[model samples]
Target chain A: MRVLGIDPGLTRCGLGVVDGRPGRAGMVAVGVIRTPSDRDTGERLLYLEDNLTTWVRRFEPDVVAIERVFADVNVASVMTTAHATAIALLVAAKAGVPVAFHTPTEVKAAVTGDGRAGKAQVTQMVTSILKLTEQPRPADAADALALAICHTWRGGTEIRYAAAAARAGGPR
Target chain B: MRVLGIDPGLTRCGLGVVDGRPGRAGMVAVGVIRTPSDRDTGERLLYLEDNLTTWVRRFEPDVVAIERVFADVNVASVMTTAHATAIALLVAAKAGVPVAFHTPTEVKAAVTGDGRAGKAQVTQMVTSILKLTEQPRPADAADALALAICHTWRGGTEIRYAAAAARAGGPR
Candidate 1:
């Protein structure tokens, strides 16, 4: 299965696409969608939406995996991130792509075999797993790829709950 | 001038349109957009977007006025509302329409001459201002019309700040 993973944010939205089954996945693409904070908020959101729509159309992934957010000290920033995530979810649904969400811990555990793995450990595992000569630049890009890798390994089981629930219950 | 007012929510999004200035404004239209809780969150958002797009096209208001959200005990609900508001603002931006936000206190004060006005008093004032024989059914419908009226009366000065800020920088 092809999976498009997103680490959604207003200013820097991480994106990655992976193809193949668990443990045999190959990286298709990895990048981030950045919006200038100086622009209008509506324009920033529109930028994210328009570009994300372009990505989904171009990659045409079978599933979309988004990193789940719990809380943050900056409520304003969290709201923006939440709105970005909502836009991503809506885009996936409009394209009929199944959507799943994985918490930061779950992603770390799936990739590094430790729920509490720090950014360095996660980055190391992602580079080795993807067989990349160097770590992906700008942490967000690496995080997006890590999300895709995590989903490839653990998404099938988690999909039975998160994805299914979202498709049925309208976004809890 | 024409104004479109929005009281955004996940379950019921209230909308109304008015034309003319301050005390002479006349109601153009009013209604609510409802989304079933059973649908997926993505689908719900898509549904809202499509319907709202239709409303904006049909109304063709000069300015869009949306209720500003503050701290709510229900973070989840607030997030959904903020997302809805974001969608509205983005839609306005996409259409090149001016958009503004008004707090609940401002709306109440503009409509009833008191920031702490009770719901009934606001409803009464809205009925009188719109020259409606009876108050609009369902609190949301009335609230929407009140928002439209509030903008007509108080939006001019507010727009210099809110609308200008949004058009130049982004949604606030």
Candidate 2:
């Protein structure tokens, strides 16, 4: 299965695509979207949407995974972040890709065995899991990769639940 | 000149288009982007971006006008609004269109002759100004149109200031 992970933001968004099978997982593509300073909010969103749409079209991931907002802090920032996140989800939905959300804590826990893992630690774990020569820069990209990893593990639990339900003749 | 105005929000956004020429200003389009409640924040933003981009491409506006956030309440809400605004600006810039911003009071003053006009009064003025058969269905769309009209009137101020600057520099 192919999965796309995203770390959404106004100025920079980190995106990563990965492929996984029964016993193997590999990174496909990863990059950051940087918006210009002179541009206004609307322009930045458009830039992100256009770039992200093109990236999704090119990568063709079967599923999309993104980090969920943690708190209700700073209403404006949250809304802006939410807007960025919304665009990511909308793209996947439009492209017929199912979306899964993972909290930062869950992602950190899955990747580093710690719920409160620091950004650097999460980056290191992502590099280690992906077996990359160097860590993904800007922190956002690495977090995105970690989010993908968390989705893989979480998805495994969902599969088990489905199998259990199927054996019990319940909804799958 | 064609101008697009945007009223950014978390779930729904108001979009308004107007043609501006010193004396004549007419509404070209006005509508709201509605998002599903079940969708997450990231998903909503993506949807807005896609729809807005389509609007920009289809309408080919020469300039874009958007409202500025000034209220002190709900800081996070303001931030998200700002992000949405940024997205609009980014899209216009990409299309090689300039952007102008106006505050709530300014737009109200331009449309209703009062800076502190209530939402109902603003809506009435917007409907009258655009010669619409009925009030703009959504309050946000009406406010967005007000911003567009404000931009048309305010745009000349910049030209006048530029002329003054040029004259000041002439053989002085």
> For each candidate, what's the DockQ?
0.49, 0.32
Candidate 1, residues A20-90, lDDT tens digits: the string is 66676788998889998898877888888889999999999988999888644467777788779878977
Best by TM-score: 1
The regions of model 2 sitting more than 4 angstroms off are A21-25, A36-51, A70-83, B9-12, B21-24, B33-60, B69-95, B128-134, B163-172
Tens-digit lDDT string for candidate 2 (B22-121):
4458999998887565865546655666788899998898778888775375655665665466556656766778888788889998888999999999
Candidate 2 lDDT score at position B104: 88
TM-score of chain A of 1: 0.88
TM-score result, candidate 1: 0.87
Q: Would you estimate the TM-scores of all the predictions?
A: 0.87, 0.78
iRMSD, model 1, in Å: 1.6
Writing each residue's lDDT as its tens digit, candidate 2 over A54-162 gives: 9889999878888878435665566567657756765676677888989888989988899999999999988888889999988988888787777877776788798
Taken in order, the candidates have interface RMSDs of 1.6, 4.8
- Measured with C-alpha atoms, the lDDT of residue B149 in candidate 2 is 79
